[model samples]
Target: MTRTATSAHPLDVALELEPVGDGTVTGRTTAAYANMVGPFGGITAATMLSAALRHPERLGDPVSLTVNFAGPVADGPFTIDARPTRTNNSTQHWTIEMTQDGVVATTATAVFALRRDSWTSTEVAPPAAPGAESVEPTPGPEFIRWMSNYDMRFVDGGLTDIDGERGDSTTTLWIRDNPARALDFPGLTAMCDSFYPRVFLRRGQMCPAGTVSLTIYFHVDADTLSEQGDDAVLATARAQHFGRSYFDQSAELWGRGGALLATSHQVMYFKV
Candidate 1:
């Protein structure tokens, strides 16, 4: 029997939230978006940010966000509580948490700022990797449900090797929603977390690994986002250091025409 695809984009379905009053919102994890251990970390992060975006008192747009995965989030329903800790004339700060079974599973803080015309420049260069059409799409593992939702064309560093032969932890790929959805903050937020853990690329084998914390800085404004529409973005991620049970990965997402859209960093937990 053929499986029927979900009509709503996985990101959209995962981010669907219901307000429960007092700055609280609730959502559930969809099986179509599951990771090895739980829901993909990126979706969860976006869900947390969604609470803040949906908050009645929110101001402006997301400038920077930090999410801490305090514990594993089980499948089923979860709750997010967001509060504006402070608000200023041009900026706003918020604190958010996700809870499952009455236990805090994730916590996050975000800063939103109103943009104004100012001196703008980017010193970071765009990816020198081959164009997306020149490379083959990276095949995702069958166990990772979320991979099916994206079309990932890799220039280098994919899940191809798993026997400690690849020698480095760097991945460059072009990614976008599989069914082609327009770019938005929540969608961009989830894409930042889409890259597989660097450990899988370096070790050439799945060693228990997961992101413990993730942070992203948005560089583009709403107008820029609308211009992106459904086009693929180039993303490159590499590990800064790996020691003991933790390591750090940094990534940059570039939109069409080579405009830098966002930068992300994460600390991951791995078992030896």
Candidate 2:
């Protein structure tokens, strides 16, 4: 069965890619998913990943993904060209480029590998923050349409106090899709970049900031995502360093019972 954008989740609708053959796809940005400066970076990343996922040559599931935002993606039509650069017995590598008006706007690389039963362990401890029900829903910025897509309960480190009162760049929150869509790899990938840019939490004011590059390592497979359903997941994000022009953010997403789903890192460009 073929899936169309209108029949899919809003996120999927926003990232809907039409196969154009020859390892290329076409997509469009929706106003409903627009962010402060442009479309949310997360959605763009997911869209780029979708190109590879939908490709006829794709193998296995995504294990790692890295997206680089080279320029602003204009709303409306865009094109993604994905090619399998390498293919191993149990893994595949892809390079994707997104362009608008014939100019490159984003590029990404992905590694897909088949999962195997093996020894596993989680070393990082989950934060002892209050449960999602204990915290009130945090209001999202009205100008950012994509903000309304998620229900967020902040346990700590939110954008509410952008005046440096908090003094640190740590944000812990519980988040789930607003319409309660089932959890999946594409959704998880979007969530990994969903944390508000660290600048707001650190400086207490909005500044010109955008993600330059983002990387996510998936820890769970398809079965794990299906088990998560539509439940809220705990997300913790913090900045390691904020320099004059750029900063780095590290984050983790954990499912119920402290199962780590993904780990993400990104470098952001900020202007005073």
TM-score of each: 0.95, 0.95
lDDT of 2 by residue, 1-272 (tens): 11233456788689778888899999899887898767999899989888998899999899999999999988889999999999999999999999998899999999999889999999998887888878898879798899798889988887676665456888899998877788888889889999988888877888888999999999988887789988899999999998889999999999978899999999999986
lDDT scores in order = 0.88, 0.89
Tens digits of per-residue lDDT, candidate 1, 1-272, equal 12345687677888999999999998999998898878988889989888998889988889999999999999999989999999999999999989999999999999998888889888999768887777778768889888888889987776665566566788888998877788888889999999877988787778788889999999987787889988888999999888989999999999988889999999999986
* Superposition error at 68 for model 1 (Å): 0.4
Residue pairs that clash (backbone atoms under 3 angstroms), model 1? 162-204, 162-205, 163-204
TM-score of 2: 0.95
TM-score, candidate number 1: 0.95
RMSD of 2: 3.1
Residue 168 displacement in candidate 1 (angstroms): 2.8
Q: Model 1: runs farther than 4 Å from truth?
A: 1-6
